[model samples]
Target: MGDPGGTDYAVSAEFYDLLQAEPDRRRAERWFAGAAGRARHGIVDFGAGTGIVTRVLLESSGVPVHAVEPAPAMRTVLMSRAAAFGADRRARLTVHPGRAEDAGLEAVADLAVAANVVGCVEPAARRALWRAAARALVPGGVLLFDPPPVGLPDGIEALEGLGPVRMGADSYLADVTRVPDRGVLRMVFDYRVERAGLAVRGAREEFPVWPAEPAVLVAEAAQAGLELVAAPHPDLLAARRPHG
Candidate 1:
């Protein structure tokens, strides 16, 4: 939840399920379903915004889940949904309030999944986030996430500057701040968006953010001591921590 509206989560959260489309959702669903088969103890949803994926993990595995979100607004939604899953019982879900960089998940879970999170910080912050995720895992645990592919067309970056991207009555656009480094570009895109059919418009800004290339993500995970289990793609990426 770490400030999806104001953060990288953005209007993507508002129309998240919609824009994610069925195929993409199924892909992620399948990925977690597979992960559930491998994870024996517990799982941590790194960004856990709204708990969409968190619920998926719980339903798929019924293992312990820690839904960590930094954004109060998103966390509220997550807690509400957690109740639906009987998460209030100590046996099920645990909610943690913090950003990925400081989530302190180490030895707390058998696996950690970042989903679409982790790409919303500066390069240093992004690396730190990955390190934190790796630390949160037990040996042989996994970290899974898919950030937007790097090398965005120059036009896309240009379009980003032309106010917010308007779809229906909502605007998914925000001002961007970028710091370029070799192949990596650290950036933050703040979005003020409204739901397509809903009457309420929620506004917020995301900061301390950025995106990275798929290869860079893998290397960073490796640097964090996670073996690349799935390389980032338009589809998915999965990585594992080897058991000693």
Candidate 2:
């Protein structure tokens, strides 16, 4: 499950505010607060787009924050937002220009988080990213993140079926529906579209979208030498690098 539909931060960065406003922000904050508590030092928001969660951790939780954003445009927005939150002060913040896998954090951070950014890569790449984050942490440091879901909107499949849409291809239409369970919400992605080359050509397929399922993701982390400490919700899970 590489970044299907091409998850471009430069493009998505513009609509990031809308994306965060959904239940996503609330979900992330809960896990981050818990994960940071395990850290003796401070926390780093890996792939911290626009610094939304970063600001929340700084303003609400009063945690020292460091943000990593690879997209230049997103980093720009994040820095501006951090400054507004008064996160530039030593007591509150630091902003870095990097990605989850390549951030040159000076020391092993207390926590590293990647909220809603794991879906940007294919599964193999995502595994590599997890390993990278694990390498940046201290023995007891934590890593938290959420992958999209196996169930996306049906419309998205319809749209993707139109053809394997190129990275910079024109945006297509998609509608998402929520299937509620006792605890978590499963999103069924529905897409509608016609083929690109042959205007008359069209089709649809349902991809079992398991964005970032806790079982699979946690297992991957464990394989990378992380220990699953807590997973408050399926959509939100936390693992800590094992201590000696």
Candidate 3:
């Protein structure tokens, strides 16, 4: 099943970096550093939106990185950011215009990562994604990713929100809605940009996420020929392809 919301990132791309700036940076640093310590060369980043994680991996290691992303707007931004890198760094990066399932990458990576992308894929496509990740890795290579929290929190309704965060002349509010039957979380962000003391511009975008259970993910990985391993961090899962 495809994403029903379509390319909402085309609209939210303007604020994507700003909204996720610090947290994504820190996450990229921590995750890529760990991956780099183990993998000797070649890293593949699936769903490499805006190249945030790609940049971190490039800087953390001298290994070649294949950044795979499907969204046109996100890929444009990622390519633009990668162009800013030095010749040596830029030469080490290759942008793949496809999703994990059709990335057409060689099975040579020592490490593969999906970061927060797993939740974005529909449940039916998740098994294929795991298989593709397995195909992209060398024997004994590692795959690391973060899955969404299992089930709903107690006492929370379908929708939940907090106060808006203001940055400069712009302010934004975030709301998340749980669709239990579909196993998806729909996140909406409303933004208002002020101009000449007037709130002249506004945008509302929705991003739907499908979170999988840990047990289910482990089973999927096993079907993809990956063995679930203990992750160094609690927030991420590590799976390794069998050496034999």
Candidate 4:
């Protein structure tokens, strides 16, 4: 989770949900809910990110949920959402402040997830997460994650139009450019907001991500003592720890 705005998700935190509403659900959210519905024990959501998936997990799964998020801005939003939940759901949720690798969960979860978060850090950090999840999971538990759908292009590629999401008179727009630099993928998010045809605010948010291709991802998981399970989608991954 490399920082650009003095914090990991400082700039994008406000507009994240609005801009990512549909695409985020389409990516893996539906499946995430289904998995939670089928879960028996507990769940660990690494990089819980504004409690989007955390909300789903809390609703579908009767088990306790540990939501881990590192960014203060993102966590603030996450806490807001979790606090608004009814007593039952709120009681089952515990929000933690840390990265996935630093979450000292010891064999307490039936499932562990790193939703759309694996590429946020470098290879070593990703491996640390895998190992941490392996340690936190029950012997037969599974670890799941959504990897980046697209990587940085050979040099630089830009997409000028993403959306102009309208929430009343305010219009939010997002554009992105991908740059391959120094063995990492840098995604620059250009965000703008308009109030009744007047530009109000804008931000250029940069995120450095690891381009973990499928083969390399699998290898890394195996090295952390987890074996690849049948993935729900070709773009997603699930790895299971050995039954001891």
Candidate 1, superposed: residue stretches over 4 Å from native: 1-27, 87-90, 157-209, 230-234
Give the best candidate by TM-score: 4
Q: lDDT (0-100) at residue 48 of candidate 3?
A: 83
What RMSD value applies to candidate 4?
2.7
Residues 1-244 of candidate 1 have per-residue lDDT tens digits of 3532225444445544333334444665766767765678888887787777877777777578887787766677677767787634436788888776566666877777777666555567677766777777888777777665475334324223324445766655445545454545545444445466443444443334355577888798789877887543436677787788
The residue-by-residue lDDT of candidate 3 on 1-244, one tens digit each, is 1121124377767767766756787987876676765667689888888888888888888788988888888888888889898899999899887667777776769898887777777776677778888898999888888875666444324454433557766565444454444455665666556545567677777766776678989998899899999776778888898898
Tens digits of per-residue lDDT for model 2, 132-218: 767877777877766556543433121221122332433333344454443334434444333454333222322223355657777
Ranking by lDDT: 4, 3, 1, 2
Better of 1 and 2 by TM-score: 1
Off by over 4 Å in 3: 1-8, 153-182, 196-198
2 against 3, candidate with superior TM-score = 3
Show model 2 residue runs off by greater than 4 Å: 1-7, 18-25, 60-63, 87-91, 151-216
For each candidate in turn, give its C-alpha RMSD to the true structure in angstroms.
5.9, 9.1, 3.4, 2.7
What shift in Å separates residue 106 of candidate 3 from its native position after superposition? 2.8
Give Cα distance to truth, residue 205, candidate 3, Å: 1.6
> Using alpha carbons, what is the TM-score of model 4?
0.90
Superior candidate under lDDT, 2 versus 3? 3
